[model samples]
Target: MASAADNPLGTYLRDRRTRLDPAAFGFGGGRRRTPGLRREEVASRANISATWYTWLEQGRGGAPSADVLDRIAKGLMLTEPEREHLYMLGLGRPPEARYRPVDGISPRLQRVLDGMTLSPAIIKTAMWDVVGWNRAATLLLTDYATLPPDGRNILRLMFGNAQARARNADWDSVARFVVAAFRADMTRAGGSAAAAGLVAELSALSPDFDRLWRDNDVVAHNEGVKRLHHPVAGPLAMEFATFTVEGRPDLGMIVYNPATSADAERLHRLLAAAPDG
Candidate 1:
């Protein structure tokens, strides 16, 4: 079933291999005609046989397994997107989602966040890790920047952080819904090892998490009205909607709009009083 169109995979791998600096792989002193790591060197780094890797680059090794492709990706120092590309070209599918902490927002997305001056907006991964937020979001929700990268997880903060628990007007109901939504996400990810590990860690940390996870409840939190007990602004009525970012199904953008004129006025005052960064 192999076609010439898929030849790009072999070409891409070769290009990546040639671009890798040999010095980075501790081959600084060796005399080499090529500017990058040799094929055998890459094979060694990827922990595969030279013959197999050569065959792979020659497009004669047939389709590679996910694990092998992943190793090659690491060996070549591919970015997340590059790794995904390598898998797609080599295996005709993307690799399963793994837990890796990311706190990056594209410049375009950052601008979108900045534009939501009145509405609180946040960008989260499929695993519910808080990666980016606007000023309003920090004022309403917890200040994601203040939390450790790993601690920015919505579920983790909900269950373990006292500050987050205090911000919720209805802790019990919100916690149940959060757990259910998280369960649904985990299920959709095919119950990856990373998801299971997160569940295990949370289960051990919070009794509530343990109970809810065991119950096997699942739901999608597409949109809802949330009552938040803001520390400075007091009670605020907000309607939030979740949207999946185009081309990045792994990310969701949640925006919170004030439900009433009074709430909007209060948010405006709070934002105005705060120093602009």
Candidate 2:
């Protein structure tokens, strides 16, 4: 059987406590032995025994019940994601369960993607899983449909594979942006088993990923530029834009297109000449 020390609940509690500010929580600053709220403080706020809280922090207490955790979440003033994380650590739920998806892409939005015949557009899940794309996107980007399930993760491919590196001209900047974006998602979706699992997998798979994850950085995937070495079109520079799905909050659609008229013409010619594969 796994001990409390091995459990994620304890670690989650410890991490959260350490991150809280006394001023933010309306606590007075005095010469203190520890940085954040003491175990007794959390226990008192949550209406629990100090010993129980201490034992929990020490990784010796039994798993906390949902109701009990709710009390702690309230005491800690946890955000929605933070509350979900507390539950996940105490219990176990996938990350997708924690966040309500935005309004799924409307037909209007679908039409927008379809209208951009010269551009590449793809919709991806919160975990960067590709959900949908237009035919032009498929043609412009590498044949992502042909890749194996695990290999399809854009971040995984960017960092883990040499072939992907060879195709991108500005690999370093792209890598930084990707890591920052992923870190942002992890912050919003922290404590999810799926998200945690993804982080663990990436950390183990690439040393660059391990270094970047340790930085504790975060950023939204709003917009960016990418230069790709297409097999048929050769090198092309493109600007990318991202839009969140309205109903499906967990989905983000990103589109890419050549930044210059000449590049656009080159892309059209290449696509026209390309053989059906």
Per lDDT, the best of the predicted structures is 1
Worst 10 residues of 2 by lDDT: 94-103
Over 4 Å off, model 2: 1-115, 275-277
TM-score per candidate: 0.69, 0.59
In order, candidate lDDTs are 0.85, 0.75
Candidate 1, residue 182: lDDT: 80
Q: On residues 1-277, what C-alpha lDDT tens digit does candidate 2 reach at each position?
A: 3355686677778778877787776788587888888777888889999898877777676877776887888888888678877877777852342343332346777687778777889877667766566667778775666877566678878888888878888777778878889777656644467777888999999998888888877787898778888777888888999886653546678988788987898888876776655
What tens-digit string does per-residue lDDT give for candidate 1 at 1-277? Answer: 2344658787888889989888777877668887788899999989999999988888886899988998899899998789989988988887765544456889999999999898899998878998899998887787788788888899999999998899899889999999998877666555667777888999999999999889988899799988889888888889999997654657789999989999988888888888765
lDDT of 2: 0.75
- Model 1's alpha-carbon lDDT is 0.85
Report clashes for each candidate as comma-separated counts. Answer: 0, 10
* Error in Å for residue 148 of model 1: 7.1
TM for candidate 1 is 0.69
